[model samples]
Target: MQLRQMTDPNLILFDVEAESKEQVIKQLVSKLAKEDYLESEQPFLEAVLQREEVSPTGMERGLAIPHGKSTAVKKAAFAVARLKTPLEDWESIDPTNKVQLVFLIAIPTNEGGSTHLEVLSTLSTNLMRDGYMEGLMATNSKEEFLSRLDIEEKVKSNSDKKYDKTVVAITACATGIAHTYMAAEALEKAGHELGVNVLVEKQGANGIEDELTPSVIEKADAVIFATDIAPKQKERFAGKSYVQTRVAEPLRQAKEMIQKALSNPDGVVEENDSEEASQSSSSSNGSGGFLKDAVQAVMTGISYMIPVIVAAGLMMGIAKLGAMPFGLVNELHEAKYATHSNELFVILHHLDKFGVLIFKFMYPIFAAFVAYSLADRVGLVAGFIGGAFAGGLHHTFWGIEGIPSGFLGALILGLAAGYISRFLNQKIQLSKNFQAMKPMFLIPAISVLSTFFLNFYVIDPVFGGLNVVLRNWIESAQGTGDVVLASIIASATAFDLGGPINKAAGAIAIGLAADQVYPLTARVLAIVIPPIGLGLATVIDKYVVGRRVFEADLRVAGNTALLLGFIAISEGAIPFMLRNPLITIPINIIGAIVGASTAVLLGAVQWLPLPAFWGWPLVDNLWAYLLGLVVGASFIAFANIFIRFAMIKKRELAA
Candidate 1:
């Protein structure tokens, strides 16, 4: 449908008097509601505001396209307005440009397919034309404005020129918002100027638009992938000569990149090689490039593994509660198992066993997904086999008996499995008829077999031995006044929130619990302190620094942190940490150390692996645990408040 068809005369507002962007949006939404285009205003307004937070839609030449897709929208519609006064401080790519023309678009939230995207693309393209925008702005009335929108002008093509290159490109960004479409536009404009035929596909918030067909890809002279993350179905570009770079690069230097691609076609690396190098090069400036990638892979695994952990942990906690009626709590804690004459107790014991069964596979799932992220589907079997082997699934592989390799070994084997599968994928290419069987049989058989032997003979022995040594050291530190060890565990657990290091500490704690180490006081405190501390920081900020500094989203985040913190999810603090890592991270670490050390010194004991507030009743020396949380959270609150006040003062002085 045409852009003009989506709007009505009643939806158009002339000489709109709005002082701020919020007022402008509210006015437009009110109009939309009045016109029966929106069923509810609040939800639609919230969705639009949330989108604005990610990146503002204010474009160049006094234009702003504020849009939202939600169930609150009764129909796809547009509301146009001409502001009587320009609003300052609205986020725009060009800060000097004050927006005068507003186009508010409302789309159905559940609308399947790329209908909204098509409309957006068309509207954005037309807005780029100086004549089209000027004509619309010149309209004196709603009918005139609608008439101006109906006057479509044909875009002259430069296809008559004899250009040798036919380029196909894909553009994507992390959020798949403004930059994705902007890059596509830039590249297309550049292609037109250069008299080269270019087909640009946009992978944006709505999904892929103008997707490249196999025939188009096969006929293209070169491919350009502009993305911050790896493109989906990346294997499609496997054999094609391609230029890969960050999404923003095209917006900045599209002509230069295109020229370079045309000139040096042979220089374009294979898809896998380019991706690996891209990942490496992006982090090359830092010494921790490999470490960051490894952490990212593990964190990907952790995010997927969390639901399993929570479910199993809660089940075990309930089982403990069930055993209490039979007076078998202490016995179950000691023996890690119990039998009772009561049928209810028997069922609880079975539930505990079932939870344990699911829990044991956590690391394996972690390993498999980590590999999948790295090498896609081919890595699944290999990663799972490697992780299972690490978990001591086949202790006597080839008559070489070994211990369970634990999390450390799982980490190593997971990466190895991914790389192994990646290597196989790169090397092997079957005929078309046999290609379908490769992923199902050939790749899995070879990758799993290789990973199995490697883990059993090499990785397991080395990491398994180191794992034993580390556990013994930690065990030895227990009951001793080993402040250093306690502090280290606490710091590591809080360092990355729920990233690799935190997960590593958690894995160790869980392992120890399985081994009949009833009281993992320090580790449990570490898990709870960071999130609680950060939540306290937000509360303190509201009182000391004022709510204006928190913004709408940060306030929402702060509220979320409190609930998540109570549930022992340290990841709740990640947004705060990311905002001011220098200040927030150090404060979190200090709070974690204080809480963990206090818990250990006070002899707080926790039998269950569950970390939620509901499990507090199961802790030994419960008062001490609560006291540690209060003390550490207080430290975080005070420190955070002071730091924020100082920063705000500094900014004011600079202003």
Candidate 2:
């Protein structure tokens, strides 16, 4: 179908209002339904939303293209919307850009194979042209909009002129829409300005375009791969000096990157080795060494683990709340409560048990996902098996009884399993006939067996000892006094906010709480203080400090931070901290330390893991806890103000 034929007047909306990506998709779907383009709107809407979630369609320059193919659509069609305001947190490839123009594509399931591709290709190509986008945006009526799409030929640039230095670059992103093209454009412009000939191959949602041939690579002095993810067929650039960076870097500093590439054109080449040796080297040093890879793997696990932790923690808190009034708080975990005459008590008791069961899987999930991040599905099974073994699964190796190894052991097992699986994946190759079984059976079966033996013999013993030392140290700190222990935990929790260090401290606190050590109170304080402190700083900067230190975007974020802080989400402070990390991060850590120390000194105790404001009543010294929070937040606010003023004065002096 032609562009105009699919884009009817009824399917085009002007100045549409939507607060979120989902809402925008729904609105566009509703418009398509009004034109009788869909057999069912809800299914089509869901399909579109699912597609958007897989990788946001939001591109640079205030544009978004959300499309789906489903049986719910009776005909292939297009729905367009010009948003009155931009959609924030829409996962644009360029984070700085908010989506203002949306194109929604709906295709019949049967028609998607080729018809859909053709239409999408046409639209995507037209969208990339500046004159076409400008003309479309300037259109006042549906007819005018349709007429703008009638361009016979795409725009061409005369800057294709030859230059002395030739370079080839690839620009890609996870979403492969906005940042890919934006980086390509930026590099091209920068190359022209610097009298360098640059040809950029864009790997975008529409697929690879302007592919770099072997001749081009041979002719180019150097190459650049600006991507968030590793580009497909990366070995193609082997032996060529290449500069790697996040896609957005080129958009901001293309000239500097080009200069660096020119100066040092010889990049590190992958070594030729036996498959086994290659895998070993890759696991140890290929991706910036084992330490960096381990950190990244652990962070990936934590990102997935947080949701489960939050859900289970909330359920356990609610269960405690229900049992507290009946004087059954301690009995909530007892088996006798399962048969209690009071139905509510029994239900709460079961919920508490269920929460505990889920909590038990926390380490296993963390370990499994870490391996999965490194070695995909095969590593998942291996990691889970290793983690389970570490989590007190009975095992007899060389007649030595193994004990529960805990979180630290799980961390080691995860890394070991990931490397083992990655090695097997790279080194092993089956006959073509059995290739399918390799992924489904051979890889998983071998990886699991190998990881299990390694963990049982090597990783478990080493990390298990380390885990014991860690636990003993924590116990010793607790015995010395609450202040020291609380300070340490608080510092770790605030140091990286929701990052690896923060999650490690939080995980330890959860483990300690399971043993009835009562460090959750300090953890709860650490969780709330950073976000609240940052939010309070923004308010103080606006009203009390007698100036608006924060920009409009930051002022908006302050409100979100306050809301999230009340619910004990420390990650809400990340955006604010990123702006002035040197100032903001130190103040946040200090605030957390002060708050945690004061809470512990005042004997604040929490029986529930809930971080909500309503959980205040669960604390032993509620007023003291509140006082600690206020004092810590006050310090953060004043420190932020002072830092901002100092920065401003420095800028003035420099000027």
Candidate 3:
């Protein structure tokens, strides 16, 4: 939970003889591996590589923290190395962007608790000192190097003196990597140099690392998030300093950004001018550039919306089953009741009767949050209007009453609210007296009014047209009832396993889930299969190459991956990819596509999204689903064996 707790003195390598940056990384990682600081070098190396791919670890002012989450890391660890010669790496706020001091942090992928944050925060605060990094780099002895950080003071939380300065910050980027950490460090360093103790946090693929403790955060003058990724626990900085920006500006114009944040606590920054901002925004959105914000916004919305979705979805599932046992539908429905008897239905029935209303309205709540992330204050009203419109439209189309669009309507509605609110804000003017009323009254009122009318009139007709077109297309595809198209989609869906093709399939599945036509199980499986099945492939052929992954590290990754796979977690694949992407990716693709295709042909029903219900098996046909899993897993295993053999042969040739 503290920085020193994770730092091993033995892993601290100073005055090393490494010719290249890669050599430095390998030496440190190999040492960690040999010392059992990590489970193995391959996973740690892979994590480092993966992190590199996302964003370079090099920071401004000659510091870099290249960190990753891995099952290879048995315990959280800090591998500190001060380069004897300056080594080149990706950097933020660096024209050359080379690295000298490298801190490779290895954390267990499962340590999702505060441990990750603690390490990140500790490093940020300590390294923010202007002399701190130089001191470490200057030290020839390992003892002096670790001592430079004053690691002991960090361990004794009570000994630290709290400096109160309003330190504004930002965290944003395309990959959400190097710049995120660098900008935070720059700001923290600015505070430190200015005699202000600053606490900075970063948001990245690995999650929020180095979060300033609440005590530290509360005592701070203010906080700034220069990030495209949504800052975790935003409400924590409510009363104090808070601001948002694109990643680049904080690094490019560090002092200016900090000064601006200090000046305006509630002010919002659009770093449209910075190259980092433009590049990042472009990468995140692509052709549908507007959608770049959409993914993060929706993800944040969904994350917040999960508790509601789970509560409501499960309640309804229970209620439906309960109604069946009570003869609410028919005794024939009892056949489906093989999985659950009257006893289970009894619990479900109560939930349905008492909790349906709350669950039923979950979509609207979800939409509201999504809208809020986009258009801020005005989005709340517009989001609700959009959700209501979608629900009403569904009712009108099917000649049914009270059917909620759930996440689908929420998604569409949130987007609609965002656009509408943004447009309205541009058109409207705020009077001095009515300033307080902007977020509270004017923005919401106009946005809601505009979105409601548009969705009811314009959006409904569009939905009807699309729905008809889709139904017809599906029927045409299934003309002979062979489900060939569905099978093809399934195959394609699983082909690449988190690659471009895989993502495309996932998008399509998510779209179907929104439409209520595709079962929740299919979508969940699509998400789960790549990570899980790849894990399975690794487990099945742990000794495929004999020397590559046939060890304790592979076993650890395999077992952890299996657990994550059953739960439909994508993180499970990370371990295998770190060890061997060449083998793992291809194997994952085969399994994912085969399983998906078979499930499509078999028509397995997925009732809930990945969050609430995953890996239950047999909603449509448990045996059929199980069969698909076997086919998929086997395909990947065989492919991996071939790839691993080739890799071994290549290594032998080199040797």
Which one wins on lDDT?
Answer: 2
Ten-residue stretch with the least lDDT total in model 3? 276-285
lDDT of each: 0.69, 0.70, 0.56
Sorted on lDDT, highest at the top, how do the candidates line up? 2, 1, 3
The per-candidate count of clashes, in order, stands at 0, 1, 18
Comparing 1 and 2 on TM-score, the stronger one: 1
* TM-score per model over all chains: 0.66, 0.53, 0.49
Q: Where does candidate 1 stray beyond 4 Å?
A: 9-24, 46-72, 80-103, 109-115, 121-161, 175-177, 204-208, 265-377, 383-415, 428-442, 453-489, 492-522, 531-565, 569-591, 594-611, 615-655
Better-scoring candidate (lDDT), 2 or 3: 2
Clashing pairs in 2: 241-267
TM-score of 2: 0.53
Among all windows of ten consecutive residues in candidate 1, which has the lowest summed lDDT? 276-285
Write candidate 3's Cα lDDT for 1-655 as tens digits: 3454567678887666666656777877887787787777797798876664333455656677777788888877778777677765333334344567777777788884555645655565565545776677777776666556664433225336555564634465545544566577676556555656556666664676666676776566666667654554454554454555566555556666566557654432221221211001111212443655676567556545545544544455555545654545222234344446656654554555454465445556667767766655556678866765654544655587432332344567788787666555544545665545555666778778777677666665565454445445543553344345454345444443333344444555566567765554444555566655555655555234332223223444455555545544344344354334455655665566677667656766655554222335326676666666667666766676666657655754764
Q: Pick the candidate with the highest TM-score.
A: 1
lDDT, candidate 2, equals 0.70
